[model samples]
Target chain A: MNEELKHYNDRAENLILNHLESGNVSKMIKDASIYSIQAGGKRFRPYLVFATLKSFGLDPAAGLSAAGAIEMIHTYSLIHDDLPAMDDDNYRRGQLTNHKVHGEAVAILAGDNLLTESFNVLAEDESLPADIRIQLVQVVSRAAGQSGMIGGQMLDIEAEGKNITMDELVMIHRHKTGKLIVAPIESAAIIAAADDETKALLLRFAEYLGILFQIRDDILDVEGDMSVTGKLSGSDARKEKVTYVSTYGLNGAKEQLELLKDDAEEILENLSSKLDTDELYSVLQMFAVREQ
Target chain B: MNEELKHYNDRAENLILNHLESGNVSKMIKDASIYSIQAGGKRFRPYLVFATLKSFGLDPAAGLSAAGAIEMIHTYSLIHDDLPAMDDDNYRRGQLTNHKVHGEAVAILAGDNLLTESFNVLAEDESLPADIRIQLVQVVSRAAGQSGMIGGQMLDIEAEGKNITMDELVMIHRHKTGKLIVAPIESAAIIAAADDETKALLLRFAEYLGILFQIRDDILDVEGDMSVTGKLSGSDARKEKVTYVSTYGLNGAKEQLELLKDDAEEILENLSSKLDTDELYSVLQMFAVREQ
Candidate 1:
């Protein structure tokens, strides 16, 4: 990864790990939560938070709490999703999944702990004003709650082994993955106190980025090496779950990714006159071509 | 239930049910969440919120959002606790548990949905000022998260079939059940803007009430009817899990309950000179001699 990306990644990791370590919770739960957290992911969502803030000429450090909170939410979702009752995966990120390491009950509780503590993290952030903190909580809860990520997950599970239409597939991914991806950028906007118009443009840019992220994910699932991707290739195909690749063939999915990249570029271009777009362009490039 | 108690119960029910029914989530999650919410419990925690607010001479309705949010957290914990990997119970409140009705995956998602949305409810509540709402989020999250209810639950699961000391048992119950029970009363104190001393005294009263509540629960498990309690009779003993009854003799447990009741009453008596303690007394009475 580039030095700038590594900086955001390290900051988010330190913030989350420090918070988890200092808590007075049960030792077992604390260990389980920290285990999955320290398991490596790219910290893509935190990058969006930092990059968006930098785009607005604000210090990226201002986005640290929001970045950490979003990453915690992301990590918790992965823990629950890997449970035997859910996706039943034994490996994630080339390591034993949470349930495989901890017992199922502990994994579930660890996920619960992370999810519950995320809101507390935002609420207790002394750097932000009370009102801004509340807004962050509101945005995050809505994105992760029934009408958002959970809702999408329910839809995905329901649609498994059945042929779903492209629109239906998009709807599911939009809810399941899109909302959370949008959350970090939107939170950055709120922190920057961007005007309504800038916020809307950033939101549109985020939507394209979310779809771009998923299409790239689907492509990676088909073409990625297990050593690099840290996932079982073609696992989605094995489950008979519909995806961008399934809906629009592999080549078609790649084509759709290109279109999304172009659209994202245009949105950033529109915002360039008002704000620095260098960091945002780097974020878009990472999303478009990330191998894992 | 008395007329006044019934009123608090009804208001809390309306607030929760209305909020659940009005969401734009997927049908499956919405149905599962509403199913658990509609399953009847005593609405005891909500009663604490309303009763505490009423004690301070504020409109009990002023406590509606906090009351609803706390109840949601309580219900989510119940749903998760009843999962097959956890207690594996098939019934709660005389109805099939969430997992039994909706399957394990949906039940897990539903529990997550309710938990995530709970913060949204408090954050979006315009009735309270922004700072107060933020405070509610912090308190509820802390009480429900790792250091509170979830932590207690982990300790309980860990202690199963093991010989544990009385202090260890107390510590587990304090984290698992005690923190959540204290949350509503502490929330009420915050809402009423009670003085620091008043808040500390009420916290002490809540601590006593939590132990009183657990002792009564242990007694109920030993000698209650399934029809009334909506749980299998003697299930605790059947599981061979330690409880107050198992540590102390049944008679000794009963003595402890009376002592706690008296202690709770004395705290109320002390507060009576400054505030209307009538509703609080009713709450204490309900905790003391309730049959179901």
Candidate 2:
């Protein structure tokens, strides 16, 4: 990660850890909830929240709660997705998956707790106005709920072991992965109170980044080592789940990644005339080529 | 149920059904979510929301979103609690539990969707001011999350098969069953914009009702028929789970229930001087004598 992006990531991490530590939950639940969070991923979603805030000439600190909230949502989704009934992965970020470390019952509750608390973090953020907090809840819930991430996940599960169309693939990723990516940026736009045009442009940029991020993930599953990726290589293939690489060849998937990167870059160029684009550009670069 | 209570219940049910039908989710998820919801449990929590609103002389419709939201949260908790890794019940409300009908994966996703959408319902309700909606979100999230419902669930699971004391049992029920019970009333108080004095009294009243409800449930498990309760009698004994009956004995638990009912009625008596308490009294009566 770039130095600036790393700084934002660390700040978001601190905010999340602090919030988790201060909650008056049961000891076991608190431990289980904190374990997966502290295991640490790229914090990519949070970085988008902070970067988008900076692009609007707003202090990134203004996006801290939102950044923390989105990361918690992301982490909770991962924990649930790794359940035995879902992906059944034993590892994440090179550590034991939540259920593997804690029992499945605790893992499920921890995920529930995290998902429930994400909205609280936003709703109780005294730093933001009540209207903004309400908007954050609205956007985040819509993105996380059935019509968004969860809906996409259902589609993906139904499509497993089948040859799905490219459009279907896009639709699945758009909701499953795209909504969350879009939500953080959209949340930052709400926090910054950006105009419709800028918000639309940012959303468009996030959509491209979402596709780009997924394609790169497919590519990594094929080419990257488990040591670096922190996920078992070729697990998607083993599960027979369709992906960008499965639908398009590896080379074709890489080509698609390039096109999405270009599209996102163009949006950043257009946005540059109005706001700082350097941090966003770094995020785009990270998405385009992140090894993990 | 009383005629007036039934009217409020039907209104809350319509709001929930309409909201569920209108969501843009996948077909399978929609079916799974709607199936459990449509299975028809008494809308008791929603009644508290509506009744509390009525107690403050607010239109019951004003609490519609909050009523629906709390019921959705309550429903989600029940679905998750019935999962194989948890209580593993095959039936709820005289029908197949969510996991028994839909696969575990879909059941889990359905519960998640419900929980997520519960907040959306509150946040997007145009009738309430943003500040009130924000407060609703904060209170509901706190009540549903780790420090409240989920936290208490953890304690209950930990206490299973153990000969727990009265204090420990109260602590567990206070969190597990109590918080959610209080949240709806608290949400209604926020919606009605009740003064601190009234709100505190309502909260206290709700706390007593929560314990009373749990005690009655325990008594019913031992004395009521499955035909009436829609649950297998002695299932709690089979699991060796601690309950009010297990701790206080049947007669002792009934005595405790009466005490709580009296305490709650006393609060209502105090509140009656300022506002209507008829609907609230009905709720308390139902809790005290409910066969199911």
Candidate 3:
């Protein structure tokens, strides 16, 4: 891992851990919330917030709250998505899923807590101007809410056992997975008070990175081994679920991933003069070719 | 309903309806979101927003978005609370629950959408100063998050079929249902930018109102007929749920309720010099005796 990226990840984990315990909520809820978030992932979303801030030459601390907020939103979505009534997955991050470990009701409430906590964390951040923090709330809410991730999840649910076109598939991933991926970058830019042009460039970078990440996920679902990925191989296909790989063959999906990677690199290159790109590019490279 | 209260309710319904439609999300998610919000209740949260604004002599329109936001949050909680994994309720507000009307997955997403949309609506509201809007988000998030309503729910869920002390029951109700009920009134005060003294008084009023409301709800659960309350009588008792009525006994609980009502009315009286109390008192009186 990039040392800077690793540092940010550690900071994010700490921020989230500390914030979860700062409240006087019941022990059970606080534990459930902590447990769910502690069930770790790649910390991709928070990394974006930090990397974006670094790119703007701002201290990564300025983006920590938003970073933690986005990650909380991501964790909450995953917790809910893995519910018995939703995906019913028994494992996540190579461990028993939230509902599988905590009873279904606890898991549901846990997700709700994380979601609600994300906003509270951001709203309470003293690092940013109150106005910017509010903007972060708005952006994060839109991305995490019905118009973005939740809406996509609904469509994904509705798409199950049904044939969906390529457009529908793109729409789902863009919302279900894409919006959250984009949120932290936007939030960081808002916090950094980056110029409109710079913010635009960051957004473009995030958009391509989001699609590329989903494409890689779909590809991995088909091509990777379960032992390496911690995910059941061919689960999407087994469920008869549509994906970029399902819509376009594995080869085509891989080809698209490469194209998006190039596009992202080009955007970063375009903004290389405006901000540091090495750390951002390194993080992007790490996510781009991960086995898991 | 009082004619003024009815006007605010209708306006709230319209704002929610329009906002849901304005989004470009899938028809399925949109419909699910709309269905839950349109399930039809007393719109008490939104009413509090308007009533608070009215008491401050501000145009009710100034409270519209915050009203809509609180209603959306309330609706989302209800949707999620009724899920099969949670309360497994099949009916809400005398109509089929969201999960029952839609699939469990859709219902979950719909609730999520409402929650996310609530922030968006508030963030996007042009009526209030940006700083006040941000304050609204902060206050609402805390009240709704793990420390407040969601945390309360965790306690409520854990308390089911178990013996609990009076203090524990009060804590559960205060967090589970009290925080949200208190949110709108606080939000309106923020919007009105009332003095610290006034805000403190409103918070006190809200605390009393919250306890009063939950006691009434518990009383209704025990004494209310389904035909009038749109809920099953003794359902809480049958579930072995701990409630004010169960913990205090009906007479004791009723006494407490009267005491809280008096406290609330007194606070309103104290604030009458700073803000009009007629509409506020009218609304409180209506809720005080509400059977449903």
Candidate 4:
């Protein structure tokens, strides 16, 4: 990852943790929210928002709340996805699950609280331009709703251990994980009032990054250790889930990631807007090849 | 419930059910959403909204979506509340629990869909006045968030085994159950442009109904039949959870409901703006003395 992008990643994570800490939840709920959120997955999605919004020279402060809100929503989704009835995973970030610590009910409610808090942060704030705020709200509602993350989830649930085509798998991952991962950048572009060409390049940039990330995730599921993954090793193997690595073989998956990384880099290079997304783009390049 | 209220109750329910069914989802999710929402409940709150808006000579069409949104939100809460981690009951309104039918994960997600859909139903449309939409959005948000339903839920969670004071129980029920139950009417009042005096009386009317409704619920838990309830009989009794009937005894709970019902009736009868909440208030009165 580029040094500048890494710095912003840390900045976004710390801000989310700090803001989330200040919210009023039951002590148990607060602690549970912090535990899963602070478990520290990559914050690339939020950093895309902060970096892209700032690439236009807007003060990062102007968008930090939205950045934090997006991350919270992301973290909440991860928590629920890791629940027993969902992914049935026992570890995250190489640690015990939220439900393992707090029990199922509290974990569920904590996720609920975080998801609900995302909108509260957006809607209650009066400092942002109302039109921009409304735009953000629309972006978020669609990105998170049934046609987006939830629909992707439906596909994932239906595809496991089943004969699913590559297109179906791509569709599932795109919505399930790609939507949120890409949303930050596209939303940032919209908020920054980027031109159509710039927006399209950014969208391409996000798609490449999202697919590369998912492919790497599938690879890790095959070979990554529990300690490194903070999750069970060979989880996809156990679920017999069809994945990029499973369908295309590890070598094919690696080649796919390389192709996506090059595409992302090319888009960043071609953008007319003089922006620091190159640093973010470089980070995706590193992410495509790096071990956890 | 009064005969007039029953007519509108049917209308309000059919309207929401149709809107809900129009959404694209798996049969399981659709059934779960409908399962929790389609059953009988006194739609007093919705009636109050339409009546208040109509009485103020505001457009009733402006209130329809909000009315539907409130009922869905209410039904979602009931579904979650009946889950094993919350109330753990197997029945509601003499029907099988949502979790029992759909399993817990789908039930939980169905609740989430309803909540998300509620906001989308408001924000995505241009039917309601922008200002009223914004204001209604804030009302529903606050009512469902930490300081409202969640806060009330936290109290209920904490108060489960304690020496329960009446004030504490009232506070829990008021915030947990009352905010949502009361919000529909207040939302109507806001949209209807009801004067402050009338709004105050409507809130009072809702307040009485919410409290009286809880008391009746407690009384029903004690005497309500297993066949009708579909719940394992005496589940609440086994836990010895705090309730109006538990604290006040049956006769005391009944008397309290009567007094509260009378107070609510007086508020409506004396409403200065000549707002008509009579039919709705009558439902509250019948529900107060209802045998389930």
Q: What is the lDDT of candidate 1?
A: 0.89
Candidate 3 — number of clashing residue pairs?
0
Query: If you assessed candidate 3 against the hidden native complex, which CAPRI class would it receive?
Result: medium
What DockQ results do all the predictions give, each relative to the true complex?
A: 0.85, 0.85, 0.77, 0.37
**Can you write out model 4's per-residue Cα lDDT over A221-265, one digit (the tens) per residue?**
888866666656687878778889888899999888888877777
Residue A226 of model 4 has an lDDT of 62
By lDDT, highest first, what's the ranking? 1, 2, 3, 4
Candidate 2 C-alpha lDDT tens digits along B1-292 = 6676568778877877787777674778888888888888888888888888888888888888888899999999999999998988898877889999999999999999899999999999998999999999999999998889999999888887778888888899999989999998999999888889999999999999998888998999999988889877887788787888887799999998888888898999999988899889988998899998
Off by over 4 Å in 2: none
Which has the higher DockQ value, candidate number 1 or candidate number 4? 1
TM-score of chain A as modeled in candidate 4: 0.89
Worst 10 residues of 4 chain B by lDDT: B1-10
Please give the clash total of every predicted structure, in order.
1, 0, 0, 1
**DockQ of model 4 vs. true complex:** 0.37
Checking candidate 2 for backbone clashes, the offending pairs are none
After superposing candidate 1, which stretches have Cα over 4 Å from the reference?
none
lDDT of 1 by residue, B185-276 (tens): 99999999999888988999998888888999999998887778876778888878778899888999999998888988898888887789
How does each model score on lDDT?
0.89, 0.89, 0.86, 0.72
Error of 1 at B221 (Å): 1.7
Candidate 4: segments with Cα more than 4 A from true spot: A1-25, A194-201, A223-227, A273-276, B1-28, B39-41, B129-131, B193-205, B222-238, B262-271, B274-292
Write the residue-wise lDDT of candidate 3 on A1-292 in tens digits: 6677679888988988998898786888888888987877888888888888888888888888999989998998888899988888898878899888889989988888888888888888876787898889889998988788887887787787888898888899899899999998999889988899999999989888889888999999998988889887998888887788888899999888988898999999999999999878986897789898
